[model samples]
Target chain A: MSWGPLALSLQVALAATALATALGVVLAGVLARARFPGSDLLDALVTAPLVLPPTVLGYALLQVVGRESVLGRAWESLTGSSLVFSRSAAVLAATVAALPLVVRSARAAMEAVDPALLGAAATLGASPPRVFLTVTLPLSRAGVLAGVTLGFARALGEFGVTLMLAGNIPGLTQTGALAIYDAVQANRDAEALGLAAVMAAVGVAAVYVGTKLGRRRVHGA
Target chain B: MAREGGALAVRVRVAGPTAERPRVDVDVSFGVGLTAVMGPSGAGKTSLLLAIAGLVRPLAGRITLGGSVLFDGSGSWVPPHRRRMALVFQHLALFPHLTAWQNVAYGVPRRSDGRDRAREWLARTRVAHVAERLPSTLSGGEAQRVALARALAAEPGALLLDEPFSSLDGRLRLALGDELKDLVEALQIPAVLVTHHLEDAQRLAARVVELEAGRLRSERPEGA
Candidate 1:
């Protein structure tokens, strides 16, 4: 019945959602507007995590940031702590797992904007930044919010990657999902059910809000 | 008033997307008045306006506004935002997310009185009553005036309009066209209005240019 795991999970999900939302909006904007060679390939790479097994993604992340790797060594030298099995590692795992939701939703929203509107803005003497800020971004508000909420929900439910990268360290890297797994294995059915129910409630609420926003977008359009 | 200069000169060739169509060439000059570009659908009238607006690049051409070079074939090109050109789209592409006043005020310098200036333009266009409404809530005529107000707020060196009266009925078209022509004349800036309607062309323009299959067919000056 410890609250530590739930608090840590919320922290990881929130941080990961923030990172994913920022990167997703930028990448989505670029992907939506850019016309160049290898753009398709880059898009596929960003989305690969969505289709790839979480364990495989976790394993790949481990290879790059594990304690024996160069990046891990550099991190240890700088921060005097190993990269793997840390709370930051959990955040990274959740971010990678949740990024596709944000990118897909945000890109769809950005692409839905009429090119004619952009042309009108330009003709009105609006610079590129002005057009994006005043026209493009504001028009795509619903989609962006939907993407952010979906990413948060996805990050909250991430288990396989969290286990592989951050491990199940009590009062540390162990998030809601990991704690649930531990509770079930230790035959603590009551604690497992409590955590699982709370996780499901938050996840469902996020999805419900996201769906409502998406519906509102359709009605507005 | 616009700076003193000869007719805005344009001599350009646009390579069509397909080889079968080859190119659409335009050789015309527009003076400080409203000139109507009339043609049937798919005749590239809109393309010509877009080219002048810097939204579409011509294969080879020079566009000079007043004495300033807007574009030339020697890799000299100005991005659309810097071209000092305003376009009122056929569909009236007012920013749906913004109120009529905000849409008109969008390109104004970020100063305290920018909104006041926008309201002035809206009042001039006679859409001040709808200034607080979003484009979606405005009627067709109201939307048209709002779009015009937004364009005029830019104080563009040139104006390009794509079928501004297309969405309205015959009577409404003529009424709106006449009002639009008066606005253009009062501003004394070079303008190109693209339309497929001969009536609109004859009514709104002092000079009418015809395009057929992507080439300029004729230019006739209406009697004063």
Candidate 2:
């Protein structure tokens, strides 16, 4: 029956989606364009979260951001902010859940761009950065946009990682999914059903948009 | 004009997959105007331009543009953007995300006060109408013009093309070929165009260099 928990989840999902997309684009560019000895390994490493269970990722996050680990200590020292058990932790969890979606889409977009166009840009005297920004990025935009939408939707549905890592703090860490869980446990049937219906509608819209964009890509080919 | 330097010189040796295999070896001097480079499949005509553009490295060779060394053995290679050489790829690799003008803009300096010049370049190439559309929306011939316009925007010391008119229909190919020939000469930069089609070679080039099995066997004028 807590509207506050629902709002927290919504904020986490939205913020997580935005953060994941920013990292995803840069990761996709490096994966697709940069050739290094461990490039493929790096790609696999980034996508590792997709196959990992959320609980396991939560456990890993607990270790890395527990205020005891070196990285966690350094972060706390630098910013005086504890990410663990906070809304930021929820965002991080959602980002981990959604990252694969964005990176996959971005990689496909980068690949769809014709290499010849890249070549022409290079020959036209554009530097590597210029060519990628002006030609490569613009060409594979549909894929990148599609990927971002899907990542956001996926983040909205993330459960285990957000619950464990952020501890479902009422009105802060509780996302829409967690709010539904909370309502179900407390026997608040009407509020649970309402939130479920809204979530279902959002889910349907996301699927519909993703499917339409996918079809356009197939036809455009 | 390239006349002051005599010709654009390249000695390209490309090693792919291994250091043991004999790389694609080519040494040639191209004159002031258009020179058609005809070769069989896998003959490495495209490889030559890639080396000049700094897209590929020659195990041992040198490329000099307008009497300035662009590449030499042992890591004396210039970056592609600074080489002052523009290339039109056989695939007509126009930027799909950008409108035609934007693609052309990529070739020139970012702060180039040359908006009018870019517009005029599109007009001259007869693609001014499509200037607002992305490359994906363009027909094959239209994409080719955008590629050429982007190259022209750079105004490089040498112009290299890999199958400039390969994908177009006959009429379009011939028309674009004529226009490109006229334009490259007007600019007076040394140019090298590659093709398997003798017709494309003859129509656009005054002299021809034939490559077979990674070697330049002969050079001849059109039809004799």
Candidate 3:
């Protein structure tokens, strides 16, 4: 009924989606083209979060960025505050949860592009970045868009990681998923159901858009 | 060391075959004219072109274009885009997302007149009518011309054609081959044409070379 948690969730999801999309697309491109030693290992590492339990991922993230860790210390020094129980932590958790989906989908899409088309662009004197921008990105737009949409949906519903890293602090870090959990614990069935319905509707809409975009083929391919 | 004539010289040892192609170890050069490379399928013809273009690293070899070293087994290497060699792929890999004119314009140097130059090349290749069409909508001949136009628009130091006419009907192949001949002569740059057809080799090449099992089997002047 408060709507505050819903607003916080939207904010966290949007920020997480932006960060995840940028990192995911770049990592996907590298994985799609590079064939160096340990490349497969690197890919597996990126994909680890997808199959790993949320609690496991949360524990791993805590080890890397908990209050006593080096990154946590650095952030505290820079920002004059701890990072573990804040909105930023929530954003980070969602980003990590959302990233693998984007990376896998975008990588498959990018790998599907004709190598001959890339070769032709190079022969035309376009630099590597130019070729990626003009040819590779345009050809893979559908997949990238789909990945971003899916990432947003994932970030929106992120519960376990967010609960672990960014504790449920009302009006500060409590998102829609966290709010639903809090409502059920307090025996507020009506509030819990309302939040659940909102989350489900938004999640379904995002998935529908993502699926449509994923199925949309490039005209000439 | 620089070669005497401004020819494109290639002497490379490519690794032996895979399921798709045989080993390719070739040492060949091209002057300011068309030199057709005749070979059988799976004979590593495409590999040779790819190596020369710097798209494939050779086990041991050197490639020099005009007076510049494009590749040396000792570690000197120029990337494909920097080599200034335009290759029209066997499948005519035109950018599907771009219109015909845009594909030609892609290689044009960033200048105020780049689009105009692209239009001129389209007209020159006689695909001006399809300038706005995507590669998928164009007929085979139209797409071929568009690919050629895109290559020539780059004003490359050398031209590499991989089975340029293999997809066309016999009559269209002959006509396009003639047009290609005239274009090569007018451009006066080293041109390498890869074809399995003896007829195409005899018709367009000033000199013809044969590849078998990934090695150069013979080299002779045209009609020899």
Candidate 4:
């Protein structure tokens, strides 16, 4: 079996999960703590991807970052390459598909942290940033870790958005899921089965790890 | 400017959650000793402490610490971190993820021998041997001591205790209160202890202030 699809799949999922985790953590922190008008509306928008059609999300991405869009034009000019139908495009697709998983899980985790602990930290002379890094972030480790794992699993299996934004370019944009699709289309049953097994194994592993992490609550936390 | 080791004057009003009692007000001052704020449940004693600690915003009034303007009605308020005050929570809230030593060291600045200072405070509070233990591993009394040590390790300008002995048994509460009173006196800083128990308040402070229905009622010397 060729290693190209597996390698590309891992690369895209890793990049996507990393991006999602970064954005998700900051967004979750704010969402968990802030009380302002329209906070609920903003929360719904962030998690909207979970319920929205993947193709619709992909179409939205295309309208904003497609080759003809301003961002895409600038990106292409700077990088001397088109943004769509590339490995980075696959990463972008995977990121969008995985973002809601990260945000929902992380926000829940952050919200579970006791406000009293934050109050104690502040009284002990820790600034807001210090309190978050030293107290809030450390205490929310289980949720953050679980969120990253779930996001990675989602990214690994992302198909619809990827097909729309990054197309299945063999040995390039073809992730494990995309490769399985290609194999089945050509009636390559053995290759399809192999790729499917690999994807399933990855998904199962991610889910198992995430479950264990999320369930391991801290006593007195 | 306020004098060093001077009093903390608090005269503030905060909006409560309901329309019936639209506001809660606190009016008091502290010199260099423990001042217990005693009240029954829902009397807003803790709210007064929170406002002084900068954890809550007051709708009007001011809190002056050692003559410095900690908060003023004219849109001037210092954030909690810069307030130079330490609060010991009833539940202890001893950073469950950190060991006793780490929790004590948390507020100490990284510079100026903070680790040694933490160890010193831990020893002072009689919890030096449990320095490596997590909060969950420690008993209620041990955790309380650690909380006190952590607060003192910060070398704060003031200290606030919110029902610090509420979790302990009756016997333990008295014993711990005696030890705490001595500790607070040794530190020579203004301290506020909020408690629903009259015994706890009288045992720990020479002056006691009473609150009822979100309003400060009376302050008197221990016997009165």
- The residue-by-residue lDDT of candidate 1 on B50-158, one tens digit each, is 8888888898889898888888999889899998788999998988888899889986655466699899989988889998888889889999999998888888887
Tens-digit lDDT track for model 1 on A1-221?
A: 88888999899999999999989988888898887899999899889988998899899999999999999999999999999999999999999988989998888888999999999999888887778877777788889889889999999999999999999999889999999999999999999999999999999999999877765663224
Point out the worst 10-residue segment of candidate 1 chain A by lDDT: A212-221
Ten contiguous residues minimizing lDDT sum, candidate 3 chain B: B1-10
Total clashing pairs for each candidate = 0, 3, 1, 1
TM-score of each: 0.94, 0.90, 0.97, 0.95
lDDT (C-alpha) at residue B118 in model 1: 92
lDDT of 3 by residue, B1-224 (tens): 12123699999888875534437888888888899998889888999999988788888889998889999999999999998889999999999999999999988866566688889999999989998898899999999999999998888888999999888998999999999999888888899999988999998999999988898999988888
How much of the real interface does each model capture, measured as fnat? 0.69, 0.69, 0.84, 0.79
Candidate 2: segments with Cα more than 4 A from true spot? A218-221, B1-6, B16-23, B126-143, B168-178, B199-204, B221-223
Which candidate model has the greater lDDT, 2 or 3? 3
Off by over 4 Å in 1: A68-78, A218-220, B1-6
Which docking band does candidate 1 fall into?
medium
> Who wins the TM-score comparison?
3
Q: Would you give the TM-score of chain B in model 2?
A: 0.93
Candidate 2 global CA lDDT score: 0.81
Ranking the candidates on lDDT from highest down gives 3, 4, 1, 2
By summed lDDT, the worst window of 10 consecutive residues in model 2 chain A runs over A212-221
TM-score of chain B of each: 0.93, 0.93, 0.94, 0.94
Name the top DockQ candidate.
Answer: 3
